[model samples]
Structures are given as structure tokens and as C-alpha cells.
Target: MSDFWLDLGFRANPYAVRALAPTADGRRLLVGRDDELAALTKRVRNSDLHPVLEGQNGVGKTSLVAVAAYVMSQDFKEGRSQQLFLPLGEPLQMKDDGSELIRDVYFAIAQAFIAHHDDLRAAGRRVPRVDDLETWLNAPTYRSSKGGGVSTPLGGGYATTGTGLNTGSAFTDSGFQTMLRRALQEAFPGNSGGFVGTLDNLELLDTSSSARRVLEEIRDPVLQLPGLRWVLCGARGIARSLANTPRLNGVLADPVDLLPVERRYIESLIDARVHVFSVDESGRANTPVNADGFGYIYDVSNENLRDTFGYAQDFALDHDPAFFLDSSPAEIENSLMAWVDNLAEKSARDVRLQGRMWRLLEDLATAGGTAAPGDHDAYGFNDRTHMRKNVVELERFDLAISSRDEVDGRRRSISLTSKGWLVHFAKKRDLLGQGALDLSMTNESPEV
Candidate 1:
């Protein structure tokens, strides 16, 4: 007889960060950031300036903003709010004249309201779906095949190309607003406090003059519409660029900056991610691991790499053997060796590393680096210009840094705390460490 055994303890690390799961359990996945989420919900309830979220990258700004849109869709049902999620990239490409963006936004809004009607119908509520109620609410307005003129739901009205009302069944660039107001009122019936919610990433569609104009025109008025609320997600660059535009200056106003998720808040977000990835019906872990692994790798690497480098270089010239013999050198060597060994081990495990890498890259990209004022909005790195775009993409993960290799060979850099990194990676990678990771610096070579 032959005995065979496999070391189950060793699983090849995928080496690639997990592809973002599309849903949480059987439902849409919503992770981390209760306060930020609540703040956005509050913004939906009160603010008119349009809730704007800005972060260095990989901070889950887009996802958070999207979650806000979904929340409004679910919470404000009675408000008859329509969630219009428009990616700026697609719209800008189709409608170079800016007419396409406006029409698309209106169409998207109308569809949202229409879906709201369907939801009501699904619940056995008597309210007519937009299709059935079109006689009174006017459904044909935005159905224009002409690709010109603004016509809204009310039918038989005239409007500009991008902004107009629906005149029955044809598309025209006119009279869209009149129909919209009536439709909204009809949907809400003048007192129930219904709303129309529009979520757009303005930076995607309009990075140029025409695009910006379209955004301002579409978003400005939407911001002020009585029961219509807009939560727009955009790069900080886009927002800054739009700041001085005459028309948008006041109408869109200054957006409430959706800052990066703070450590505590991110902890909460990681918890949510845990719940989302949970194997249970409630989608929550009974004992959540403290942090995401990839995020941990990135953060720990960043911290130890920077700190170790700094310590080594800082005292390199000093060569204080007493320090290493005492607390500093031993710590430095231990920390560096541990991180370096961990990275190698992680690579060996084929652990999905994007999130961690992104975290590290993002921190590096954003921490104290200077770019030409013109280069700020760009997403990638320019090695010649001392920039890395990979970090930008990773910044979406909100882990990045800025550094300079100084003349003294000391690299000035920034990093996240191990605890912070742990939580981040755990949430992002959807895996918790089997046991607490020892962070203390020691003289032994790091062994996984």
C-alpha cells in the first residue's frame, strides 16, 4: 500500500488581485464607508451643489459614488427619482457636437423614471408605468431617431439640440424641460416628495471645451431642479477645470469634496467588503480578518521599504553599529528582509498582487511629487517626467505615494500603517491572514 499526502496549507497564490466581484452575495455588493455613504445619502437629502467625490485613486470613489446612486434609487422610490448613470467617455465619443451627451442624459433619466413606474407596478401599486401613462405623461418625447433637435415627453414642443422637451414620439432639441417638470409632478402627484436622481462621471465625456460646456449645461440645471438630485463622480482635475467656467461657476457651484476614505471609515468599509464576501446568508464574517492581504502587501511593503530605506540611508553615513546592535540596525535589517521576503513569497504563491501593487504605486504617485501644472490631470506616469501612470490606475485603490531619489541616495517617500494596509488589503483581496502578522523587526530572515 502506498500513502499519498498533499500539503493543503500551500495554495498557489493567484498573483493577480481578485477581479472585483460584481455582486455582494446574491445582491449587489456594497463595501466599506458607512460615514461617507451616510454623508452622500445626506447630500441626496439636502445639498444642491451635486455631491462630488475626489480621491487620489483606488480609494473606491467611483464605487462609493455609484453606491450612492443605487441607494437613492432604492430609498427615494416615492420621490420618483430616476438614477441617470452616464459614463463621460461613451457620450463624448458619440456626440462630438455635445448634443449627444444632453440627449443621452435626458433619455437615461426618462428611462429611470420609466423603470420606477415598472417597480411600482411590480409591487401591485396602481400607478401607471411610464409606458402606460404616456398618454398623460407623454412618452414619445425622447425617442427621436433624427439625431437632431430636442423634443421631450410632452410632445409637440421645440428645444435646442441638447436641451429640450419630448414632443410625443419624436426626438427634438426643444421643450424637454416642460415635459420633464410635468412628468416629475405627475409621477409624484404634487406632494409625496418624490425625486429624480442622476449619477454621471462628468470627466469621462467632456475633457475638452465642447464637452465641458455640455456637462455644465446638462449638470448645472439638473443641480437646481427642485426634486432632482445629481451625484456626479469625477477626477479632481475635471472639477478644477470646470471651476472657472462662467456658466457652471454658480449653477453647478463647488462640489462637496468626497474625500478619500479615512482609516477608521475604511475599516468600516473593509468590514462591509467582508460581509459582502461572506459565505453566510447575511454576507458577513463571524470573525472578520483585520485586513485584506494584497492591500497589506502593498502597504507593508511601502512602509517597510520607505522606512527601512530611510533608516538605512539616514544612518548609512553615520554607520552607528551601536544602533543596529541596540535597536535601529537590527530593526532595519529585520524589517527590510521581512518585507522583501514576503514580496518574494507572495510572488511565489502567485497571489493576486494588483491591489497591493496598486496601493503601493498609488501612494508613491501621489505623495509629494511635482508634475508640470499641465500634467496633473493625466492618469499615467511619464518616466522622463518622473511620473508613473500605473500608479494612477492603482490610485483608484487609494494607495499611492510621491517620492524623489535625492542626491544623498535617500529616497523620501510616504507609506500607510501596517494596520491600515492590512485592513485595506483584506477588504480588497477578500482574504484574511490565518493569524496575526508579526510586524516587529527582528534579525532573522523573513520566512512565510
Candidate 2:
């Protein structure tokens, strides 16, 4: 079927499903994390010192960590590592209470262990199967009661051995702590084997005492197992605070704080996208009519495509584009903010266009690049209808599409146009030019 007349509403959006393909991390869309990946692998395999992947949001810390873990698991068959993903964004109530926080941390870790039990068992590890671990992790202090609140276990911490063993009994703080330590030892196998853990989002347990205690206990020299290593991925704020606590001093003292994915690497990402868009899975470029030279290639919101493309490419090429540019943070921010302002204006003008454009920007800001279509809406952006309209308008801009897909069933996808890129530049230029452009031009459509 011709690309033009395909019913898009029924067809899935390629740009929407787009993700940077997974790397060694089991994800198809992992772009630009070589150094971070190497460093994390080393820390996980060689050191007792807990390594944390620290960075701002959208910096690809989690993706890097996940990739490392996936690599470790594959490379070392004997040394099976399980990822205990803790997405603690919402800080628990009582930010500073240590004991309560510790309890929460224990539960969180225990849950991770439980979730990946089958994987652990298949690897010849001696850790108690997930079921037993779950039982041990659930504390005696909190029981689901008929009322909403948890009920405390009676004669907690000890089993009633005078008769049948009390299955309902809960573990005390000390007991829970002991169970956790055992679990760690079992999985890690002190001095015997290697285990890598990638724990993400430590910022959520803010004041929870339980969380801090987990770090302390895990990092304790006494609990040191030769093969057991931890790599934490979280915000700089979490790492900073973790550094302050004496308990976490050793664990977080040495961390790899990630910056934005190097621009060159980002460019590599774009290049890859260009390749995929222009060619098929086998790598042959798509053939078409004589116009435009090559097959279809989009330049959505052309403002920053080249620049963003350049930044990613330069980073990938040199590994340290910043060293060459000598640009300051303020300069980078100035450039970025200009791009943002342009996006804002674009979004405001074309109701349909604005939604998809802003949604893409948010995805870039939050999750690095455009996520799979379903995931975009999940991240709090426009729905499919908005996306469809934007694609039609953008394609129409380049004469790629002759008419609108007002009908419910139409196969359409969005690719930025050269003109769209100009629009992006115009918006950013407008943003950068305070008194340069007339503010009175605001109400008018962006017809250049």
C-alpha cells in the first residue's frame, strides 16, 4: 500500500512507538552510556564500595544502570545479579524518622528479592526461594487488620512452640534486621561469589529511618561479602543528603554523578534514527519518486534537531564535547531555554500542533527521547487524537500529505519538516530576542 493513503488512526504511530533500541541492558532504546556503563560494571564486579549513579532527571542514569545489570547477568553465568528497582519518588511520611524508614527499606528490598525469585533460583544461588524471603521480609509490627490500620503481632518476634508453630507471628525490629542480613548474605555469598544490584530512585525514602539503615547495613564492613556489590541510581539531591548521613558516608562518598547524555552520543542516537527511518531492518534505503533526492526524513520542530543532533553526535565522537566547546552551564541553559520558549509558542498557536510538540518536549525532558506511544500519554501528555492531527498538519506542511485525515481511519505518522525546524528556530529566536522581535506579533499565526 502507498504511504500516503494508509488509514493512520487504525495504524500505530512509528514516532510514537519510537525508543532508542535496547543495548546490553535488555532495552532496545538505550543510547549513549558507554563510560557510565563501564564504570558501573567495574564498581559492581570489583568493589565493596557502593557506587551510586547520580544525575538530574532525564540524564539516562537508570537506563545506564539497567544496561550494566543486564550485562553482568549475561557475562557472568555463575555471578547472577538481580535488579531491585526501587522507584521511590514520593517521600514517605516523616522524612527523618530512622527506624520507621529502616522498616520501609527492608520491605522494599525484600520485595525486589521476591519479585525476581525465579531468576535467582535458576542461577544456582543458595538464597532462600522467594516465598520464604517474602515471609521473612513482612514485619510483625504491621498486619492488615479488619480496620484500615495494621495490627501488631501478639508476642511478636517469637514463635509459640508450646503447641503448633504460630504462623501469624511477626518478626521484631531486631528479627527483621537479622532476616535482612541473612537474605543479603545468602544472595551475595560472602567472599564466595559476585552479585550486582542496581537500585534506582533513593530519594523517595527522604526522612524514613528504615531507608538509611538499609544503606548502613548493606555498606557495613561486617556485612561485606566479596561478590556482593551495589550500584544506586538516583537524583543528586538523594546522593547529596545520603553523603551527609554518617551511616551512608562510606556508601555514597564515592559516586558517579551522571550529566546529560553527551551530545555526540545524542547525535549518534539521531543518526541511528535517521538510518532507521530511511532504511528497512535489513539496512536498504527506501526508494521513491525523483523529488527530494532521498526517501522520507522528518525534521520535526526543526529548531533544535540539528543542534540536539550535533550535541549528541559531538559527545559520541569525542566523549567530552564540553572540553572542546568551553561553554558554561549558563550558555547551555540559554540555548536550551530558547528552544523551550519556541516550543511553548508553537504549542500555544496550533492547538493540535502545540499538544504533540509539547508532548515531545516533555518526553525529551523527562525520559531522554520520545517514548513508545502508549508510554507518552502515561507520562502525562496528549492523547492519540492530538498526535494524529499534529502528524497530518506537519506532513501537510511539506506537501507530504495532500489533505487532512478528518476521517476516523487514516494511517499517518509525524516527521518534523525542514520548515518545521525553521519554526522551531523562529520560536527559539523569538524567545532569545527580547526586544528584537515585536511582542505585538504574539496574537498572529506564525506565518513566515
| Maximum-lDDT candidate | 2
What is the per-residue lDDT of model 2 for residues 204-264, given as tens digits with 9 covering 90 to 100?
4433243465557545432243334555665424454455576665555465667665444
- lDDT by residue (274-371, candidate 1, tens digit) is 45444554643322113332233334433232222222232222333333334543454555445444433343232223433433333433452223
- Measured against the true structure, the TM-scores of the candidates, in listed sequence, are 0.49, 0.47
TM-score between model 1 and native:
0.49
Query: Least accurate stretch of 10 residues (summed lDDT) in model 1?
Result: 2-11
Q: Residue 58 of candidate 1: its Cα lDDT?
A: 41
TM-score of 2: 0.47
How many angstroms is residue 360 displaced in model 2 relative to the true structure, after the best TM-score fit?
26
Total clashing pairs for each candidate: 85, 47
